[model samples]
Target: MKFAIAVFSPAHAPSSRRALLFAQAALAGGHEIVRLFFYQDGVHSASANVVAPQDELDVAGQWRSFITEHQLDAVVCIAAALRRGVLNAEEAQRYQRPAVNLPAPWELSGLGQLHEGAQSADRLMCFGGD
Candidate 1:
């Protein structure tokens, strides 16, 4: 089955870890992931500055690796990211920020990507959010 995942929790949240694990398991089971959309606080999962303790799982790193390894379409919501201070190179320069925390393989786009993912995929699964 084809799936589109929308994650709305912060990287430190258990829901974020569960979302990653669910994606991994789906891939392992031979399912196709059309896209992974990070919205709201979930954009933190794509931040390069995320650092977890030694005893805990590095959720952001794991997400990065998984998405890159699978060559998955991972998107971080541009508006949400900007509002939360998550910036890419172009965005950082445009906003006159000193640094860029979001990196490669994860694109920053509008909510239209999420809409497209939902419209195209067989299932649109959402994790976290109120």
Candidate 2:
């Protein structure tokens, strides 16, 4: 089956961890993930500046590695990212920001990408929502 996953929780949240585990299980089961949409606070998972404590798991790094290893399409909502101060190189330059926190393999896009993912995938699984 083809799946589209959308995560709405922060990187430190349990829901985010659950989402990652679920993705791994799905892949192990021979399922395909069409896209992973990081919405709202979930965009934090794509931030390269994230620094986890020594005892805590590096959720952002885990996400980056998993996405890259699987060659998955990971998209973060541009508006949400901007609102939460997560900027990529182009966005940082355009906004005159001193630094860019979001890294590669995670593209900053619009909600239209989420819609497209939903349309293209056989299932759309959403994790963490208020």
Candidate 3:
């Protein structure tokens, strides 16, 4: 099965973790991820500037590695990301933010990417309630 996974919850949330786990299971079961769109607070999961506390694992890092390893399309909603101060280098320079956080393995894109993924994928799974 081909899947398009859309995540909306913040990283470290149980729902978000469950979503990733589900994606892993799907992949292990011979399913393919056509796309993984991160919107709302979920965009933070693709932000490179995020630093979890010493006790917490880096969920974003985990996703980055997973997506890259699997060669899955990982995209973030630009509007949602900018709204939360998650900016790529160009955006950060344009906005004069202190730093550029979002990086490779996570592409900044529009919601249309999600729609395209849905159109192409066999199943569209919305995680953490979209």
Q: Pick the candidate with the highest lDDT.
A: 1
lDDT of each: 0.95, 0.94, 0.88
- Candidate 2 regions exceeding 4 Å error are none
Candidate 1: what lDDT?
0.95
How does each model score on TM-score? 0.97, 0.97, 0.93
Winner of 1 and 3 under TM-score: 1
In candidate 2 the C-alpha lDDT for residue 97 amounts to 91
lDDT of 3 at 97: 91
What residue pairs are clashing in model 2? none
For candidate 2, lDDT tens digit of each residue in 33-111?
9999999999987899989999999988999999999999999999999999999999999999999998798899999
Q: After superposition on all CA atoms, what RMSD does each candidate show versus the true structure?
A: 1.1, 1.1, 1.6
lDDT of 3: 0.88
**Best first by lDDT, ranked:** 1, 2, 3
- Which candidate number has the best TM-score? 1
Ranking of all predicted structures according to TM-score, beginning with the best and ending with the worst:
1, 2, 3
Residues 1-130 of candidate 3 have per-residue lDDT tens digits of 8999999987777667777899999999999999999999998888887777889877877888888898889999999999999999889899899988888878899999999999999999988743
